[model samples]
Target: MKITSVIARQLLDTKTRPLVEVEIRTDTGHVGLGAAPTGSSVGVHEAFVLRDGNPAEYDGLSVHHAVASVTDHIAPALVGAELDLRVLDQKMIDLDGTSDKSKLGSNAIYSTSIALLRASAAAAGVPTYTYVADLMGLPPVSTVPVPSFNMINGGRYGDLTQPFNEFLVMPYKAESIEQAVEKSVKVFKVLDQLLTEKIGHKPQVASSYGYAAPSADPREVLQILAEAVDRAGCSDIMAFALDCASSEMYDKTAHTYELNGRRVSSAELIDYTRQLSEEFPLVFVEDLLDEDDWDGYTQAVAEIPKTIILGDDLIVTNRERLERAVELSAVDGFILKPNQVGTISEALDCYSYGQDRGLLAIPSGRSGGVIDDVVMDLSVGLGVPFQKNGAPRSGERIEKLNFLLRVADSVPHCSMADVSALVKA
Candidate 1:
């Protein structure tokens, strides 16, 4: 069947920012819905996210132009095209000749592309995840991944001015997503309690992810979270990770990165991260260096060879950038942010590239995600997957976890991911 029409509209995410939500109607009247997620800590190399610049409307972040572009340019062109992955995405790339998808906006492109995938699956009477797997030559997506819950956020996510961006925990030995969630929530609750006791105020919510606490010392925050792991009785299943997002805090003029009121050189940052890995059950350290710091990434990877040195902005989910990372011997893993690159095929290709090299493929959610749980499904389709979809908060973040839990409940014999393989003994 052909794609009959694509309807797009400007909408608000849970963060009250303007977002684009899309609905694709096929010739058979099958419909699919999708939303493009954005982030507070954006990578410079990422594809464009167009917005209106007028201050009066939507605080200069309006997506009305993008919505218009999708309706006026994108929809009419793809209306009669055959419904499939390659054709639609290729036509989109052809329409927007820029390498980084600036002309048409990555938000517009991703929302429409995602809508096509969902609508195609609905038209074929198959689950979206199953359809994605079949298209990618993957087996049925029966593996229920352990969810990496970002229980604490900082450096633009909330009022907390911590150096690192995200502090998350997941259950490593849980038998299923349900069990993983159960174990993680216990840690989150205990962490919340500890933060309240430490500061005489409850940890405030940070966006769609975890609780936010005021602490200058990253190790202290980890210590509190570790205690929560102990108090929850979830040490058997629980493990922690960090998203440094150091690019934001790096002072290029000063040639040092900001860290808890101190200037940290790249070497110093690497050493600090190395210490954290040695001291805690930190399986992943993402974006530890500035995006363009290949030497820094190589040093960190060399020093902490066991933990997953995931490249978020370092690679920006682009295969060419990933190749550059390989050439530099920078990272052993990469974070998959779908909007960063702009298509399902490209995202799958990024995962395949990592899989070919036996690198860690950690799919993650954006800072201001919408309600769709497609990321959770995409991660599960990768088999024994790991994902960062935010904490078990109400709204869009929990929607993703709920989707995983349903996947586990609906599918029989789904097992926990073997994350130990990616970590030091």
Candidate 2:
């Protein structure tokens, strides 16, 4: 099928931030829609999201420039092109000819790339996951990735003083995605009740749809989560994960981290992370160190051998960065965010590289995301071990989780991805 027309427009994300949305129409009457998700604590090396610097609109956060880039440049080049995802994505990359995709904007490019993928899949008369698996040269598998539900928020996403960005619960023991979501939702409700009773009112929801932490101490928040799990009768099936987003707390000049109202060196921070792992049933600690602190990450990975040391900002879904991480053995897994690298093909390449190096892949959603559910298909298609979309609340977050539920019902013999290997001994 050939691309017939392309349209681009500005849209507001979940956080009311401006983002670019692209729609591609094929000659076969298939229309694919996609939008770029922005991050609250973005990595320094991630792809640039173009924003109009005019302060009058959205406080200089408007994506009009991105929308224009898509309409003026991307559409003109791709309107009559083949509907092959790889070919179209490469055409966009070649046209932009920039390492970071600043010419046409990562937001514009990613939105178009994902739209092309969906349009091609629709033309192929197969589900998006099946099409993605075929493109990656993988056999069709009926594995739904374990969902990591972010239950507590801190750092940049919330008003809490805690340095950690997200505290998550993973119902890894659940036999199916439906069971896992049910268990996680129960825990979330229990936590909501507990927080309301403790805080004397309804708790605030953070940017990622997680409840704002009621305490500055990370331990206190974790304890509350543990209590919620116990109350929900999910203690045995649930494991924990943390996204420290440590770069947000790093003091570059002091060579330390401002953690919980105290300054600590890299070694001290690593020690603190290890202590937390020991105190809780933590399966992974993401971005536990600064993005550029390769030595600190290597040290953390070496010291915390049992728990998965996962990198998000550290790698930024870049293949070259992932290769460097493999050389340094800095982390056991990396978060895959498509917009971080500007294209689904690039994200898939990075994921394939990590898999070849024996690293885990966790497809994740950004806090300022739209209601797109392609990430869910990506996870199921790749047979990823886990996926992170915030708590099973809010429309955007629920859309992704609900996609997993639908996939579980549709795929024959589908089962939740095994996470026993990720369980800490």
- The TM-score of candidate 2 is 0.96
lDDT of 2 at 57: 93
Residue pairs with backbone overlap in model 2:
none
Candidate 2, residues 1-425, lDDT tens digits: the string is 78999999998988899988899998889988988888888899999889999999999999998899999999999998878888889999998999999999999999999999998888889988899999899989778888899999886434547789899999988877888999899999999999999999998887667899888788899999999999999998898999999998898999999777789999999998888888898989999999999999999989987699999999999999999999999999999998899999999999999999899889998888777657877998898888897988889888888888888888888888887976773
Off by over 4 Å in 2: 156-160
For residues 1-425, could you state the per-residue lDDT of candidate 1 as single tens digits? Answer: 88887899999877789988889988898998888888888999998999999899978999998898799989998989888867888889889899999899999998888888889789879888878778779888767677888888776433447888888887877876678888887788888888888889876777545777468678988888888899889888788899989998988787788787789899999998888888888878999989988899999989985578999998999999998888888998899888899887788888888788877778888877778656776887767467786777868877887888787777787666776666662
Give the alpha-carbon lDDT of every model: 0.83, 0.89
Model 2 clash tally, residue pairs = 0
Worst-scoring 10-residue span by lDDT in model 2? 154-163
How well does each candidate superpose onto the true structure, as a TM-score?
Answer: 0.96, 0.96
Candidate 1 Cα misplacement greater than 4 A, ranges = 156-160
Whole-structure CA lDDT of model 2? 0.89
Candidate 1 positional error at 160, Å: 7.0
